[model samples]
Target: MKALIVYASVHHQNTEKVAKVMAEELGADLVPIGQAQPSTLTAYDLIGFGSGVYGKKFHKTLIQFVEALPAVTGKRAFIFSTSGGGEIQTHAAPKKLLMNRGFSIVGDFSCKGWTTWGPLKLFGGTNKGRPNEEDLEEARVFARGLKEKYI
Candidate 1:
């Protein structure tokens, strides 16, 4: 029941915060998407992908990485995202993408985060101080459940 969390949280570390909380709860390895190697994907039983939503999707690089990932059928995976103004549906892209590649969509999670990037930055961002402590605790609780159910 090994687990790994690979994430890309560029702006303000919003997504990273959620990933870390979940990782600690699940006792999973945490790796930045930029530094993750293909071999890293093979080591885990349950792999979780996390990212901050950009225009209703996970980071382009994260999607590309999964697209290029070596074939492995029936592998379990979960998707999580931090967003300024979106919901769990924004996680659908990653879920669909992974499902297309033979990874089982075991679970998913989402939460709002303080985002001040792109055009939203000019307007002083949204969800200030979000993905806050309460939100992170929710993430931890969710991770615990995923561990019990999926791992």
Candidate 2:
């Protein structure tokens, strides 16, 4: 199935790294959330929204983008995020938003990322050198599995 991975990876480009691997594995379109238009979402059978977690949420721009999208009932979708904590709950806000729009939540992924922003910067960073080879491979595997399950 056709898929698009729209993401916003700032700080260390951690989430962007994951998005690229997923895009390669799924043969999907890759675009920054800033470049994505809500009107074009229907072209893909599957949509992936990803971001570096900021204060326990996906990037604001992505959330806003999804909110602006026209009613996309029953669309297939996945969520991914990069964070110092790498908590699954970080995906909650966006997941809820998508579900409210009637998108099916097929799967979600999260991985620790090097984060040195704010107070964490005082400790150098967390998950240094993360989204490393192993992490990317896991993401690749995850994408392949999603393809198997949904496509």
Candidate 3:
């Protein structure tokens, strides 16, 4: 199945790392959202949208991209994200946005990453070296499941 992984990352590029692993597992193409113009979803059978969580939401670029995507209707799609905290809205808001746009939500993935700002990084570090090896492995397995079930 053909898939497009569109992502935006700042700071550590942790989300991109996960996106690459998912793309490799699915044999999909990687497209950075910044370089990609809003396009029709008809060309792909599966779509994976991702970004780093910023302030309980996805990167602004990703939000705009999802908002502007052509109606996905029956097409399979998934949302993944990386964040320093475990708050569900960091992932949930974007998934909700996409689902509201008529895309079928197949699966969602998220993991903690080192916070680049604020107090989280002040005391040692939280989730340092992550979206680490284990996170990527989990992403690969999740991608396999998405392909098997939806693709």
lDDT of each: 0.88, 0.89, 0.82
TM-score of 1: 0.92
lDDT of 3 at 130: 86
Score residue 96 of candidate 3 by CA lDDT.
Answer: 79
Worst ten-residue run, lDDT, model 3? Answer: 85-94
Which one wins on lDDT? 2
Sorted on TM-score, best first, the list reads: 2, 1, 3
Q: Supply candidate 3's per-residue lDDT for 147.
A: 81
Per-residue CA lDDT of candidate 1, range 1-151, in tens?
Answer: 8999999988889999999999999999999999998788887889999999887778988988888888787689989999887489877777877888788988888889998877878878889899999999999999999989877
Summarize candidate 2's per-residue lDDT along 1-151 as a digit string, tens digits: 6899999997799999999999998989999988999977988889999999888878889889989987776589999998988888978788888998889989999999998878868888778899899999989999999988876
TM-score of 3: 0.90
Q: Which sections of candidate 2 miss by over 4 Å?
A: none
- Report the Cα lDDT for residue 72, model 3: 59
Model 2 TM-score, all chains together: 0.95
Candidate 1 or 2, higher lDDT?
Answer: 2
Q: Estimate each model's TM-score.
A: 0.92, 0.95, 0.90
